[model samples]
Target chain A: MIVAAMLTLAVGTYLIRLAGPLLRTRITFPPGAERLLDVSAVVLLTALVAVTALTEGGGPADAARPAGVLVAGVLAWRKAPFMAIVLAAAATTALLRLL
Target chain B: MLVCLAVGATAVSYGAISVASGLPFWFPVVMGTLVLAGSSEFLFVGIVGAGGSPVAAVLAGLLVNSRHLPYGLALPDVLGGGWRRWLGVHIMNDESVVFALTRKDPARSYWECGIGVLLCWPLGALLGAALGSAVSDPNDFGLDAMFPAVILALILPQLRDAKARRPALLGAVIALVCVPLLPVGLPLLASLGALAVVPFLDRTTVEQGQA
Candidate 1:
């Protein structure tokens, strides 16, 4: 089951990735659609962050996780190195969980 | 490079956690190469680990990856056509796209970043698989927090642009609100509804420009 699912997902995702370049010449997105595409990365990414940080098993995660993500956010906002941001978040969460 | 290190760190966690969840170590190592996209792979492992149906996991993972459609659109030039384009698209992920767009030579940067991540992600997974047994609980070390933290860091710079900020904020709100109500991947898909505000935001920008 795992292997089959992974294979299907890999193929499906590959097609989605290819759809843009393949269709780029044949079709043109309207300006609004293009604008939506432009912002989609940030929008989707923000949503991913929110969902991953706040939810677990279709519900709210513990306070420690969100608090840790908040720390990472502040560090990221300050342009800290990627490793530092990750480490800080992990450390903060682990410490909070320990308490 | 720094990008490779960041991806490797997260991939390590992914590998370890997937193994700890009862997936065979080789499974994540292989998936890391085949899927290549971190977020969706994580979602897939999380669902299947929790005993969700494989069909459901695949569907949810595909939904999580729908963002790649726009990512591919944004980088048509970087991924020039021909047989090479196949590899190009296969390696397209959040890290590659983000890094490629920021460089002066996007085509070269894209390939270099993409290939680097491709190498490190799977290798990191392999290494973490080896270490998975040492750490019985990824959450105890707060490894679970790393995925979202890294992703948040990636998008933070993009959010600095006022044009992008509004939609991101709205999308986040949409996802957060739907978290409890929706299935694992559906909330993220529903967040796409935030794009509805883009037209209105564009009009305001245009009007302000003329003023």
Candidate 2:
């Protein structure tokens, strides 16, 4: 099952990734949808962040992880460097787990 | 180099966790190369580890990865044609997509992806798999926390733009509401549904008579 799923996803994902290069010239978004496309990355990424941070294995995330993400989110908002952001978040969570 | 390492970190940790979770040793190495998708691979492992159906895993992965469509449109110049195009698209992921879009050059994308795919990602996974027993419970080292933290930090810069504020906030709200009700990735996908309201939102000009 795992191998089959991996192969299916690998193939399907390749096609999905290729769709951009292949369809670039063929289909264009209408004006209204085009505007949405502009901000779609932000909206979708933000939504993804919420899911990744706040949930785990299809359910609510545990306390330590969400708290860690909160710390990271604040540092990110303050424009901390990437390394610092990851380092601090892991530290915070690891420390929390110890406590 | 930095980007390559950054992309590899999550894969390494995920590989470690997957192996710790009893996935075969070659799982990450094979999946890392064949799939070359960071987030979906993580999601796939998470689902499969939980004994979910393989078809469901692939479906969830597709929905999560559909964002690549817009990414392709964002970088239409990705591949000219031929086998190179296949190889190029196969390496497409969040990092390469963002790199391509920001640089406005597919060559840079290919270069960075070469760094991530050809060098860092698979090797990281292999190393993690090799050390699987030593790194049991990735969460103890905060590997679990790090994944979302890293992703959120990378995308945080985009929110500095004032125009992104509303759609981002509303999308968060929509997705959060759906989290409890929907399946794993569907909430995030439904968040895109919030885009439909973009045309109607904050349209003071459209509501001229309201004043």
Candidate 3:
């Protein structure tokens, strides 16, 4: 099931990528639909960040986890390097848990 | 270029983090090779690793990747024609698209960065998987928080656009509210409701943002 799911996602994404080059001349997405697509990426990713950072086992995760993620967000907003953000976020959370 | 190294780094984290999340060791490597989109792969690992249904993971991945459709429309020339186009479209990604837009030769830049990320991502995943398998408890290293942090960092650029920010903030609130009420995956799905509010947003400013 996992393999099948991965394949389905891969193929579907490839098709979406292909649709533009192949169908650009023949088809056009309505402006409203285009806007929806644009917003969907941010909307879904924000939810992912929220859930993964804030909730676990259907409740809020330990405060340390969210605090670590909050620090990561500030660094990212400040344009820190990706590796630094990852390392610092992990370290912050680990150190907090130890305390 | 440096983009390849950044891509590889993220793949390493994805590999290690997904494994730490209890996915099979091989999953990240294969998905990195096949899907080759960082955000969607992360979404898949994040959702499926959390015990969400495979259907939900795939749905989330597709929606996140739908932006590629517009990217494709803009890059037909870079894709070339004939059999090469297949590989071209496969390599289309956020990094490649940015390089294609900014570089002197769109086709060359597209292929170089796209193929560069393509090679590094899966290889990095394999290496991270080896490291991840040795760890007994991911949370001990706080690896569990890495996924969300990486995702937050990736989307930070998008959120700078006020047009994107409003919907994203609303969607996040909706998802959080649904967290206690819905099952694991459904809240993310329910977050789609925030997009409905987009039509009512000021389209003129949004058009400028897109431009």
Candidate 4:
């Protein structure tokens, strides 16, 4: 059942994804809407990150996770390599876990 | 080539995170293969693991994925016409669309875009699953700490201009406040709530840009 669910979900997602190219010709956003759509990615992604970084254990973490996220934010602002931001945060978490 | 690299990199990263977090190897593999959207899949797994209902998981996944609807509406012209063109557009995601739209070569084809996304989807899932199975201690490499940060890093480059930036900041603030107040699935709802405000708050900006 799990496998079936997974497969169904996968196909549905693929279909959803495919909708863009398939309908590319049949539909069009107005010029103004197109501009708004362009920024949608940023809004969507930021909300995602915020939810992940801030919330934990069914509620917001008091400090440690946010601290880790802040470190990551700084690395991100510095435009450090992707690996570095990840490493810095993970290392901080592991260290905090130990202490 | 860059598209291929991005897909490949994402697959590897996901694989590492899943394995480190002790997720079933098959889960992330299936997620990558089926969901195709990275953030949504991650949210689904995290929610399910945290004991959220499957229905909630599905709704959250769909909400995060709602952005694709507009992308669908916008892409038809670029893909041209026909059944094949339709199939191509249906599979288009952020990476493929950006690649297709920005290709300097006028001759660049939607076929290439379709093929790239389709091919990468499974390969990434398989790779992540395989790697997850192989790594006994995924945390030794510090992947758990790195994964969300890496995901966030990938997300940042998309915030291009002031109009987008304002809503993004608003959404982030809402998410932060909601984090303390909501359950697993409700935060996603709150995020959507944040997004719902984008049109209302930025009507002037949207109007100005559209004009």
Which candidate number maximizes DockQ? 1
What is candidate 4's lDDT per residue for B74-119, written digit by digit as tens? Answer: 4424555567664554556655544444345412544675577567
Candidate 1 residue-wise lDDT, B40-146, digit = tens: 88889988989999999899889878878767776637877788888999999877777665557878988998999899999999988889977566688787788
Error of 1 at B141 (Å): 2.6
Worst lDDT run of 10 residues, candidate 2 chain B, spans: B97-106
Lowest summed lDDT window (length 10), candidate 3 chain A:
A33-42
What is each model's TM-score for chain A? 0.84, 0.84, 0.72, 0.82
How much does each candidate deviate from the true structure in C-alpha RMSD? 2.4, 3.3, 5.8, 5.7
TM-scores for all candidates: the values are 0.88, 0.85, 0.64, 0.63
**Per-residue lDDT of model 2, residues B143-206, tens digit only:** 6787678667766766776567677878888998898898666777688787776776747445
Clashes of each: 0, 0, 0, 20
Q: Locate the minimum summed-lDDT window of 10 residues in model 4 chain A.
A: A1-10
User: What are the lDDT scores of the predictions, listed in order?
Assistant: 0.84, 0.75, 0.80, 0.60
Better of 2 and 3 by lDDT: 3
> Alpha-carbon error at B120 in model 3, in Å?
3.7
Q: Which candidate is the best by TM-score?
A: 1
Q: For residue B97, what is the lDDT in candidate 4?
A: 49
Q: Rank the candidates by DockQ, best first.
A: 1, 2, 3, 4
Tell me the tens digit of each residue's lDDT in model 1 across A1-99.
789999999999999998877776678889777777768767877888888898887778999999999999999998988889998988999999999
lDDT tens readout by residue for model 3, A1-99: 989999999999999988877776576779777667656756777788998899886798998889889999999999998788977888999899999
